[model samples]
Target chain A: MDVSEQIHAELKKCGVRLAASLPDDWVAPLIRRLDADNDIRHVPVGRESEAVMVASGAFFGGVRSVAVIGNTGLLTCTGELATLNLRHQIPVFCIVSMRGSIDDHQIYQEVQGRRTIPVLQAYDFPYRVIDRPEEIGCIPDAYQWCRLQKRPFILFLTRALLKGRRWS
Target chain B: MIAKEAIRVLAAHRGDAIAVCALGVAANEWWDATKAEDCFQMHGAMGFAASFALGLALSLPNVNIWIINSDGSLCMNPGCLLTEAAQAPRNLKHFVIDNQVYQTVGAVPMVNAGRTDYAGLARAAGIASTHTIDNVPEMEKQLPRLIAGPGPTFVVLRVEPDPSHINTPPVTYEGPEMKYRFGRALEKRFGISVFNSSGY
Candidate 1:
């Protein structure tokens, strides 16, 4: 099976009934897989913040959901994550692309690589970087931990994890 | 029409439907009118109430979901209409309370103020059923049908901006309390657990 398929199976184990996504290249395959699944209701949002909000709402509805977006998109939605998830203590798990990493040669993504973790730390949002296929099995535990934490938790997919090789 | 009165009228007709209210006037008014635990009032993320409601609607499928949005909030994230339209949850109804100004911040004029056509925007976003109601009577008259109709339907409620409303304040409970109340309320209503045994 493909890496996206493996991740999809893990998400299924999480019992994620809904997924709201705004795609970034690294996570696009996973988003497409989620969209194709009949069991997981896929919502394609215009903005990354909408995915965060949608996932938060799903939490209240007793639905497990994940937001699939890029690192840049994650940066754009910190304010929403803070005020909505942090203030209200709402748990939302997000699967974000780990862009701007050493292996990611895209110039536009460098800033995101440099800034994403610090920003998450500054906001006290927990995150886990999964750089290998073996790490994908931890998704269900991460999902449960996100619910336990009662705030936004980021599960980052590195280029190596997605493509099975370094871009560099 | 008075915004409060309009909200009151809308409140009277809301049966078992869940509400996701945007920040400022509409959310405050919703709390003032209903004191509903099942309703989730936003404190931040000004524009994403519609998105949140759409998620809820998709998840519940059997329950009606209403978003009490605002003109300012709508402008903050107009693209929500596109997302909502694409999903087209039949259980979702979107209501934009257009007061023509930022009423919570002492009634500052809205950008493009009276010229922006919100309902038209929703229609262009692929929502076939849309209405702009300028009075309480029209709101009362149209709500039943709109609620009954398939969504994502959009309705714009136009009202004069009242600076006095700024002083009215939001609901008494703060953020975390609001979460527990809302989550617990939903759990009781739907017989589904929103939290774990340890209550995270």
Candidate 2:
């Protein structure tokens, strides 16, 4: 299976029924997959924090869920991450499309990309990097860790994962 | 009646109804008058009053659920109305205290300030039973009927901004802890597992 299919299978196995996201170039394929899957309800939110809160509510309502956003979006959601997710132990499974890091072509993402790990660390959140399609399996394992810990977890996706990928 | 008066009316008619107030001075006034146990104040979160109230209404389906929200906050998550309407809970009543300003955040004027109509928005979102009250006396007279009349009601309260005096101290409970406590209470009361393994 490709990366999107692999991620979709893992989320399905983990019983993630509700998913929310902000538009991002790197995760467009994953978002499309979530949309096409009838079992998964996809909510497109205006802001990253709103997505987090919605995911939090869905989780509270006994539904397994995830929120997908770009690394820059994570910076905007710090207050939410700190108060709502971390302080409240809301297990937020975030798939962050890495941008603006070392060897990144996009200059606009550089600042946020560099700060992503430090921000997650500051909030005491555990994160893993996924540089290739094969690493998609680790997402379910990361989600399990988040469920066990009752905290937010991050899966950082580098450009390498989306490179030369076809939608189908 | 004004938003404060409506709250007072609700408090007077309290019969297993739990009030969830969003963060602001208007909410603070009502919060001050009522017991903390009966109120769930959204401290840090800006626009979650309706969502929180929805949770409470669903979890405690037997109890009457009321949300004291602001126009500014309500707009932040207009999708919440769709969610509420979709769920179609018979016991949920949302009261939007339409002050038209982000009162907590330096009184910034909300989008489409005077032009926006919350009642219309609610109706458009399929919350057919909605009411708008302009003054204290109107609210005092009409609130009872609004509360008694229907399922999933929305009230747009037009009131003057009373320089928000709801004194919320700096210290507050963590969201997780509150969620855990709420979940446990809900589980104990309703026998439903709302939270996952970590207990919210």
Candidate 3:
């Protein structure tokens, strides 16, 4: 199976009934996979913060959820994540693209590569990067861990995991 | 109309609807009016309560959801309207308390000074049923229909700034306690489990 399919299966195993996303190139396939699923409710939001807030809301309704977005988008929503999820102690699982990695030659993503982990660390938000398809299975455990942590947790998909394909 | 009075009116007709309130005045007023555990009154995240409510509405599908968003909060993220519009959950109702100022912080004037047409913005964002009410009587008159109608509805309640309630305290519970209270309330109300066996 493809990495996207593997990731989708893991999300299902994690009991994610809802997914809110604003896609970047790397996470787009997974977003499409979630969008096509009938059982999992997929919400396409205007901004990354909306996805984070939406997932936070789903927790109150007894639904497990995930927010999917790009690394840059992840930076945009940190304040919301800190204030809403951290302050309220609501756990939201986010799947993000690990932009600006060594393989990522995009100039726009360079700042994110160096700064993202430090930002998450400063906020005490937990995160793990999945660079290979085999690590996708860890999502269920991460999801549960986020729930236990009662805060925002991020599962980042690295360039290596989503590479080997050409979009243009 | 006063915010408390408007909230009281909304609470009276609330029925089974679950509410998510934005931080500050909207949340504080709702807590004061209803003292409801089912409602999640946000202490932070000033702008995204609308998105939060939409998520809950989409997830539950059977439960009614209301968002009490204030003008200052709405201005912080007006793009939420487009997201709400796109989902168009029939169970969600959006309300904005337009006091023309940040009520919690000593009545500082809002970014656009309350001249921004929020209902018009909602309508423009594709929410077909949008209403703006400026009085308690009008809210009372229209709330029954608003509650009964299929939603993704938007309502703007325009009220005068009340300096007296500016420093009103927030709800009793906050942080994790507030989280469990709201979640457990929903679980009890709907017979669903928000926490796992070990009690998250």
- The per-model lDDT (C-alpha) reads 0.90, 0.73, 0.90
| Cα distance off (Å), candidate 3, residue B9 | 1.5
- Badly placed stretches (over 4 Å) of model 1 are none
Give the per-residue lDDT of model 2 (tens digit) for A125-154.
888988767777777788888877777788
Candidate with best DockQ: 1
Worst 10 residues of 2 chain B by lDDT: B164-173
Error of 2 at B31 (Å): 4.7
Error of 1 at B86 (Å): 0.5
Model 3 stretches with alpha carbons more than 4 Å out: A165-168
Clash pairs, candidate 3, are: none
lDDT for model 1, on a 0 to 1 scale? 0.90
Greater lDDT among 2 and 3 belongs to 3
Predicted candidate 3 versus true structure: per-residue lDDT over B3-22, tens digit per residue: 87888888888898899999
List the pairs of residues colliding in candidate 2.
A88-B176, A100-A109, A100-A110, B1-B135, B1-B136, B1-B138, B1-B139, B2-B136
1 or 2, greater by DockQ: 1
